[model samples]
Target: MRLDKFLKVSRLIKRRTLAKEVSDAGRVTINGRVAKPSSEVKVGDILEIGFGAKMLRAEILELKETVKAEEAKNLYRIVE
Candidate 1:
């Protein structure tokens, strides 16, 4: 799955466009390296996102084209 798509489908960013903008601005990383909006994402990959002074890290557990709001959390697990 695409990084931006995963972000939205997983309800991490709420929207795909925002995810793209965030990613394009170098506010997102995969495995510690900066990532792009079109970056390919796979299961077990570590995703880190910067929201101003806040940082979010999540480990991808599953990939899906669409998921319900209640099930979004199952796609990734938050990491400290």
Candidate 2:
């Protein structure tokens, strides 16, 4: 799945457009390297997102086109 879509589908950023904007601004990384909005995301990939002064990191556990709000949390696992 595309990084932006994955972010939204997983409820990480809440919206696909916002995720794309954030990714385009270089505030997101995959496997430690900066990634673009269209970047591909796969299972097991590490994602680090910068949110103001805070940061969120997670590992992709699964990729789905759509997921229930209650099940979105199952798509990725938080990482330190």
Candidate 3:
């Protein structure tokens, strides 16, 4: 799955376009390297997102094309 799509489906960013914009602006990284919105996301990959004064990190667990709201959290594991 694409990084941006994964973010939206995972409910990390809420919207695909916002995720893409943030990614394009270099506010997101994969495995500690800057990643584009089109970047491929696979299971076990680490993602870090900078949200100005705050940051978020997560480990990809599953990558499905679509998931229910109740199942969204199952897609990734929050990392401290």
Candidate 4:
């Protein structure tokens, strides 16, 4: 899955466009390197997203084309 799509499908970001913008602006990273919207996302990959005044890090647990809101949380696991 693409970084932007995963972010949206996983409910980490509110929308796909927002996720793309965030990724393009270097606010998103994969494995400690800056990432783009088109970056590939796979199981076990580490993702770090920067939001104003805060940062979110998560590990991809699964990749799905679509997921319900209630099940979105199952797609990734938070990392400290």
Error of 3 at 55 (Å): 1.1
Off-target runs (Cα >4 Å) in candidate 2 are none
Better of 2 and 4 by lDDT: 2
Please list the residue runs of candidate 3 whose C-alpha ends up more than 4 Å from where it truly belongs after superposition: none
TM-score (all chains, Cα) for each model: 0.98, 0.98, 0.97, 0.97
The collision pairs in model 3 are none
lDDT for each residue of candidate 1 in 2-80, tens digit (9 for 90 to 100): 9999999999999899999999999999999999999999999999999999999999999999999999999999999
What's the lDDT of the predicted structure labeled candidate 1? 0.96
Give the C-alpha miss distance for residue 70 in model 1, angstroms.
0.1
Q: For residues 1-80, could you state the per-residue lDDT of candidate 4 as single tens digits?
A: 89999999999999999999999999999999999999998999999999998999999999999989999999999999
Instruction: Give candidate 1 regions above 4 Å deviation.
Output: none
Candidate 2 residue 37 Cα shift, in angstroms, is 0.5
Local error of candidate 4 at 47, Å?
0.4
Steric clash count of candidate 2: 0
What are the runs in model 4 whose C-alpha is more than 4 Å off?
none
Q: How do the residues 22-72 of candidate 3 rate in per-residue lDDT, one tens digit apiece?
A: 999999999999999999989999999999989999999999999999999
Clashes of 3: 0
lDDT of 2 by residue, 1-80 (tens): 89999999999999999999999999999999999999999999999999999999999999999999999999999998
| Model 2 CA lDDT for position 36 | 96
